[model samples]
Target: MEYFVHFLLAILLTALSYFVGSRIISDGVAIWQALIIGLSVVSLGALTEALGAPIWFIVLVPFPVGMLLLFLFLHEPLYTWFFTYLITLALYSVFHVIMSYFFSFHSLIPAWRLS
Candidate 1:
């Protein structure tokens, strides 16, 4: 059940990110392009994480790089992609944390809890 909820959250976040990017950048970006950007962002983060970079680097570096790629190659502006990516990451993190707490909490003791 929790996994399903998280999956849905991911889908929602991707859609929201695409919408925001399209709105801020231009209506020209196709749905496929937006989805590619979102997926690429996730892939970059995962690869970086697997390479042993700190988790913070995943959020900070990949977003800008992804936005730049989208802008330079895809013709979208940095403002649009950047803002949309940030919003998506923020929402995903928040929801993931909340769900982690709800589903993984082992005890009422705050300090003893683990995600």
Candidate 2:
């Protein structure tokens, strides 16, 4: 259940990142296009996680994949895609760090995580 919820959240975050990058940081893309890009980029990480991969290793799959997909999915130049992906990656990192800092839950053992 934890993995399931995490995957859902990751999908939403991917869409949000695409939306922000294309719509706000650069020219707007179709919502459906963003969804496609997000789905393509995050699928590998989702698969790795589902296979019980280490968290640190799972963290590494999405960056280059997302950048590659961004360039492929959008008609924009590579620099635009790269820069926007960096923005998205930075935002994702900040969100993850902030959530980890405040999050107290741990596999149904909340206090166990603190130690």
Winning model by lDDT: 2
Q: Model 2 off-target regions past 4 Å?
A: 52-56, 104-115
Compared with the true structure, what per-residue lDDT tens digits does model 1 show for residues 4-73? 4544454445545554545564554566666666566655655675688765665565667556545654
RMSD in angstroms, all models?
6.7, 4.9
Give me the runs in candidate 1 sitting further than 4 Å from their true place: 1-12, 73-115
Point out the worst 10-residue segment of candidate 1 by lDDT: 105-114
Error of 2 at 51 (Å): 3.3
* Cα lDDT computed for each candidate against the true fold: 0.54, 0.64
lDDT of model 2 at position 34: 71
lDDT of 2 by residue, 5-98 (tens): 7556656667677777776567756777777766766677667767888876666766677676677666787777777777776665555555
TM-score of each: 0.52, 0.70
